[model samples]
Target: MVAREQFQVELSKLRGDIISLAHETEKLLEKSLEALYNQDIDMANDIISYDTKLDQKELKINEDAILLIARQQPVATDLRRLIIALRISSDLERMGDNAKNIAKSTIHLGEEHGLTIHPALTDMKNIALKMVDLSIKAFEYEDITLARKLSELDDLVDSMYGEIIREMLEETATNPQKIQHIMQMAFSARYIERFADHTTNIGESILYLVKGETLNLNE
Candidate 1:
């Protein structure tokens, strides 16, 4: 009984660490999008630099989870929890990378263009951020319904992404000289779309944690 109690404590700590990583990654993504909107080169640079911290957090989580598995030899549901924790951390880290990519897009865009961002792109950003928040909540509560909703949100993101790409393509045809700027904008939209996908991946992980059933939320 004492050993089981200690294991539960460690499991709780691991869950907390995963939540912390999720929030930090979500914040980084928000800042990255803001930097893109304002064309704040300095802010974008800071986000790029900050990504290393997220990487370290993910590494620590991975190590700690591995140690728990090795020492505790958890079976069945306990083992599933640890495995899902690792998967969630990995998805969160990838989300951070997508944010970093968005920051890089901002830097590449520079300030000289004074390009106006598309309204649809802003919509994508907002939905992506919301999905990240919802994903975390769903994981915390192990709400399968909430986790399933992420797929619907992903659909919205996908639609907006397609709209952005089509519009950008139109702009590129008319203003061939601005191809570079248009390309960067498209890349940023793609990054935001990928960020949403990762959140759905987290949602799928949550479903697996609770139901012990694998799902493809990305579809």
Candidate 2:
């Protein structure tokens, strides 16, 4: 095969690896939320255990991307593709860490806390997950409009996060004994909010790859 053809193949494989990592991260986020909602210690532990797999997947993607750049010495659009892949993979890996953090928060809350999951918190999780999904789609399609839309979704997540925090603070004031549980719930909400922030980063990455300019969707 020609060198150009081989490069194309490697590029395609890199894209596939990124998509796989994205999907795995998304599932991890979903499971973490489920464990929090159900207060399932066992499930939370499993999610923590599964986080290592995401780490490995991310490492592989990073290594593959680096090797492609080294071997192909890609320039212009090809170079941009590899760079964006690296950025997206890093974002996805951090997103996985946030999910792991959420699982840890669930464990910290413990089964005996008897704390009810806040509806606003649930809304944050749902919107965060949707943002994750849409970010991947925007990257796959190179859709600037879809990528821009993620900031709007992220704004919603931020709004919901603030609502959860305010409500938790009010609850904590009324029931000082449950302050620890409330703090854990607040941390989980922050993690979800951060997860959405990373999704917005991916959206920014997509925009950069397509338009060759930097845009701060996080702001």
* Backbone collisions counted per model: 0, 0
How well is each residue in 1-219 modelled by candidate 2, as lDDT tens digits?
Answer: 366999998898889889888889889999999999998999999999999988998889899999999999998878999999999999999999999999999999988888888877777888888998899899888888999999999988888888889999999999999998999999999999999999999999999998898999977
Over the full model, what C-alpha lDDT does candidate 2 score relative to the true structure?
0.91
Instruction: Report how far off residue 6 is in candidate 1 (Å).
Output: 1.2
Writing each residue's lDDT as its tens digit, candidate 1 over 14-99 gives 99999999889889988998898899999999999999999999999999999999999998778888998899899989999999
**What are the root-mean-square deviations of the candidates from the true structure over C-alphas?**
1.2, 1.4
Off by over 4 Å in 1: 1-3
Model 2: number of backbone collisions: 0
Tell me the spans in candidate 2 whose CA falls farther than 4 Å from its real position.
Answer: 1-3
For model 1 the local lDDT of residue 31 reads: 94
